[model samples]
Target: MSATEQPVHDHSTAALDHGRRGSLGQIVSWCLWDFGSNAYNTVILSFVFSVYVTTAAAPDEQTGQQVFANMQTVAGIIVALLAPVIGVWADRVRRRRLMLSVSTLLVVASVSMCWFVLPYETHHGLKYLYLGAGLIALANMMQQVAEIFYNSMLVDISTPSNVGRISGAAWGLGYLGGVITLAATLALFVLDGGFLGVPEQDAMNYRAIAVFCAGWLLVMSVPVMIWGPPAPPAKGDARTLNVVSAYAQVFRHLRRKFRTSPQVLGFLVASAVYRDGLSAVFAFAGVIAATSYGMDTTEIIIFGLAANFAAALGAWVFGLVDDRVGPRFVILASLATMVVFGGLILAISATAMFWIGGLGISSLVGPVQSASRTLLTRVIEPGEENEMFGLYNTVGRAASWIAPGLIGIFTALLGTRLGLLGIVLTLLGGLILFWFVRIEGVTHNRSRVTSAA
Candidate 1:
């Protein structure tokens, strides 16, 4: 292969696939992991635990926002520092699943501990504030790291003919899980006084939900461990390396990619910019609804359900289209839709905006995210999959602070509603760069070659 071209490496052998077509049970198991993992996404970050930490636990509104942003900033920094190194290590050791399992266990443990983050009037310390936010931060980092490993498994269960559908199915499962889990939260916690008559005092209602979210993740996340494609030994060249060597290897890998496969570099940078924006959109969705759109807790929960449903449907439908028309189109279209919807939401300030524009914006979120993953898989080879996915998470998290950081800065200067413009800007950046990307090697020939082989 020439520089700027990807070599066709056999992906069939890695990440639980054992070089065979994956079974339905295995596919479902893999997707279910997304389902379970999203418990952390929906409950802790987007809606319940974070809302509790910021609004209920913090001293004031501004401090709450600052604290939430800072917590994520620190977590992003930690993830950025560790993701590539750990990914390098996992690839070397051929222990991606072990790494994922341990990371997931940490998420469960940390989320459950959020139960103790009782409100201020009931308990008198910044201890809960720090503790809750800290756990949320840790969980955020751990979950992200886990996803790097999880994402590597995509090739294990996919074929070029069906990769889009497989990825879309998994993405759909994630949103569907959020839909079901969030609805369960509404049924179990938000509607009633919550389990065991947990007093609304001290934010106990939210505290109980934290415990529930942990349990939810625990149950949803375990199936993949049991049923995912059996991980084979890492590629023959996969050698164990120390941390220093691991990073060295990563540097060499990046150097090779930048020179020989500039497309990879371009995709990485573009993905980093837009994915940060995508993360921010979901991260602050509930808050925006509550504050800007005047969505009550009940309404926010309902909106989350509607948004998840829309996202799940969009991902599934667009995924099939992704296979035929290509992920590039899907991504561009999704970004364009998001830019338009996000701008409209910024300009308009009413419940109608959230209901229409908010849902429209949420619909685009999944296709962009799912297509992004699918696009990356279409670009890279096998042995380096784990490392690349790690870099994916690394670069993404490296800039993770950007959207939230910009939002924090702008919100402080202007106002909450205006701060949302940051997301639009980041998306625009990614969309612009994405336009130049040319998928030369993998997308056109890999499927035919793999089928022939």
Candidate 2:
């Protein structure tokens, strides 16, 4: 066997003897990490705390928006520059568990900082907001890195035939986790008073939500660390280096890797454009609804729950399509839907119209996006999956600045309504570019060999 080839064993017989040890259980545990982690993104970062920082926490809404955008932009820059390097390190060390553990701790610590956010009256509130944002950005970087490794583990657990199912199941479970967390948070603070006589101040409730999310993340990650086996270390020089040297080596490696296959580079470029647009849909959706359509925090939370539920359903349904059809077709279809319905959202102004148009378009977003991910999985070589996903993360982070920057720019120039028009245009452009990606025959031989085995 070549150095890159994983040992082929008739584990199918062993699995049958031991009641068919399916990847489903491990996949579920892996997904639970996303579920727990995204609680921060949905409840704290995107929805509740973002509103708090912008509306109440900042000097004003304009300043809040600038600060928020700036923080994200800076983080994206750092992640874009560092991701490929760290991805190479991950591949060399095969130490995904260690990386995951370190990153999770950082997330927990950063989230716990929410407890220190004073009420809006104090000057320290703004300082706390900036500090928290910085930490959150750092934590998010770590989370992204860990996800590169975690996603790579999918190859270890499932066959090519079941990869889509496994990926879809993980994504669905994560969304379900988000739905539950959001619901619990809303019930605890918004709908009812805080647990056991706690006050119902927005800041206080948000703090509790952060703490809950942190605890949830730490706890849920335990199972995967315990049960999922580690990959063997790469058989090359594995010495660690300072960040500067690390980055230099990564750049050198990236040049070499890209030269080896231009298709990989093309995939990254196309994925970056569309993925950024997709992320923007989640990041700014609440803000658009709240500022433009007068939706309250509670309403935003409800919408988020609805969106997550739809996303979960989409992932499951699309998983089958991914296996039977192809990931590229799924992505093209989703992007087209986004362009059409997204335009309707840009045209509408009233809150009722917003909800009607938004939800109508949102229904198609989840399934197509999930299938796009499965498509990436289909293209990469197994041993290189982690590094490629790391590149995926890098491209995503690099492109992250575009949509948010566009949103900020357009909102300032044209108004929130027209800002959405810019977003729709971005999605349409991404769809057009994504369609040109040739995926039908790229990995057919490798897939055939695996299936035949």
Candidate 3:
């Protein structure tokens, strides 16, 4: 084993065991942020706005694809750069809710503005495309910052023993929210041929969905602010800080982690690769359903609902197993399942094959993600969870370009099927790297929750 791969003795897990379980209402309130924030995933990135941009906003099909790629790459870089700073700032503050509220409102405002993209045939479509790109891109960056605080809050809500279950519950509920929103979108607009008799001006159906997404996010985000716990101050002097030194602090903190427990760094790197692949899976699902699977807008939305439902079920079910078998085993199995099903979908050109394999592929998504959070919660020291989760986002975003770049390049040079190959390779590569990294500070003496799912 590599030096970094050796397991650190699990000293911190016990201290985490002492925190109150808190009421189930409180836990659900914390998870409600994830449920609400998923409007970005379902509506903008994966389903509505992305498709609108590439299909209607750009000058033509080819240009639209290129523009979409460039937008994502640029947005990913901005989010990556800002994520650590936000994490550090969040760590310094007494309440993560302050940052969370600002970021959430930005997302809400951005999606609301997307109600204007006209059809590509219109004279104003190109102008709207540029406008949509800027607004959506800004929202995307803010969403990443919001999640850094959202995830860091996990430390405040639960004890170590049930962290996996809580993580999975939040992830599952988020996907459930995705299924509900996608279904509602389909019912209200796409299936009914536009609700409220709104005249079709510039892709009015797609435009209306943007307004709906903003409303959905706004309603769901309020509960977390009202009900979640207050975080203690991070014990740092933030008044004197600037951007460059903020990153330097991150580096120094990571250095300390490396000296004390190299596996933390090792796991961070391993998880980053797979999370990129997972992001691609969500971001491109609707595009693939429409383009490659021969699905109409309504068909695509139905597929989205089914896929997200499967993901929610998988996440909740896997959480039960995670507490028993250990998160290491769960992640290994989840990644392997994704690779198999992702390949299966690419090999078969039929829509039926795509439907079966697409849902299969999605089912694994939540478990790996939820378990990654759980493992990190198991590892990080007391009072530093926010910073560690921030490092998690920073490292994850560092390689964020990998999946999208590979998808863009391979789809151009080879075919769309080859783009699927890029996602597969990311999962495979992460699984390989993760093989060497052990789950930190997993304690066996603690009782495993038998009733978690």
Candidate 4:
């Protein structure tokens, strides 16, 4: 342990009593939550439902895209405001499971409601578009809020020696789930009206997919709810904090952390910056492929599937490396490599080069994400896990506009391909910031305690 690192406390509550750190069942159950969550993250939010809302539900393509973007911006602001307060409440009452359950169910409900968003050709109104947008935005927000509790659980399920690989496995599972779900969607619904032969008259295929996503999430959520450890006993009463009080408490916590452990805050900010860059890389890679490489929609989808596979593979491999070495080393190496790959994609115009560079950057991204989560889990003090993760999400959403904004500016000034420089710059900036983040060592078997998952 580092000289400045404080001793971590162990919780002996029945809900947290884990034999052998955490059983394989417990760990696998935790990972399945990620797999199930891909229904929302991959299908509804990223690929299928969003595309339907923008292109079919709305009156026109431009209007649909604009309205959906605005709704997401609003959702992002609300999440930033609410995440910390919810985290604080969950920790105070020791009701992480209850909170997680409520949020997850809410997400399910929101996604299921997406079934009502009929295409304009069938419904002939703006209401459907607005309804679809609203439901998706709600689902997105609740999903993120659910993640606060979900991420806090990571500490409970793994030891310091294995947290890296566990986190990596979970992330890899999510990417794999996304790939499978997306491919299934294409094969079963979107391609040639699908083999199911669900009539295309009113866009029933997409609506059915929404219902499927809801069921997928609900069913997938059951394992963790049943087998996962319950929250530990509260330290005190469960008085809830209002918005003002919650923000005040969060600020006070940040101030104290800054004074006592500046690296905590440093990692939060640094990870937020680079994470945004990672998101942009995934978001814009399709755009580059279409515009620069002249890849058609079918080709783009195939590339996306391949990219997810690469990311999944990288997460699994680097996760083992993380356990042997440390998350800091994994994160630094991944981010540095990503910066170089992003530059290569920007500089090279060949189709083969785009495939190589795009997949290279994609592979690096999952490791960085997994390593970042692992590092945060290791660094936080014993009891403040939920609140710290809430801050992690908030800071991340707060800076969410950087990469997109930079991409917009650079694209306007230069061209489409050169706009990728913004992504490279954002990543380089994060790498520099992360270089200064010190991971205080902890005694693996002594002070580090089994927490939540």
lDDT of 1 by residue, 381-442 (tens): 66666788989988887777778778878788988887888888888888998888765534
For model 4, how does the per-residue alpha-carbon lDDT over 134-219 read when each residue is reduced to its tens digit?
99999999999989999988888887668888999999998898788878878887788887777787898988889888998898
Backbone clash count, each prediction separately: 4, 0, 0, 3
Candidate 2 lDDT by residue in tens digits, 1-453: 899864432211111122222365676677778777777777777777667766666767787777876786787787777777777777767787677677777877777777666555555457865765666676676677677777767666665566667777777777788788888887776676755444646467666667788888888887777766475556667766567876676677579656554555666777787777877777878978877877887899899888777777777777777666556666777778778777777665656766766765555566665665665665565446566777888877767766766877899899877677666767776777766654334323334444555
Stretch of 10 with least lDDT, candidate 2 = 11-20
Give the candidates in order of lDDT, highest first.
4, 1, 3, 2
Q: In model 3, what is the error at residue 41, expressed in angstroms?
A: 0.9
Q: In candidate 3, list every pair of residues with a backbone clash.
A: none
lDDT of each: 0.80, 0.69, 0.78, 0.82
TM-score for model 4?
0.91
lDDT of 3 by residue, 97-187 (tens): 8778888999999888888666667764467667777778878888888888788777777775677788899999999988888877777
User: Which of the predicted structures, 2 or 4, would earn the higher TM-score when compared with the native?
Assistant: 4
Error of 2 at 27 (Å): 2.1
The estimated TM-scores of all candidates read: 0.91, 0.87, 0.91, 0.91
True-structure RMSD, every candidate: 3.2, 5.4, 3.5, 4.3
Of 2 and 3, the candidate ahead on lDDT is 3
Error of 2 at 367 (Å): 3.0
Q: What is the lDDT of candidate 4?
A: 0.82
Q: After superposing candidate 1, which stretches have Cα over 4 Å from the reference?
A: 1-19, 236-239, 412-414, 441-453
Candidate 3: misplaced stretches above 4 Å?
A: 1-7, 11-15, 18-20, 236-240, 443-453
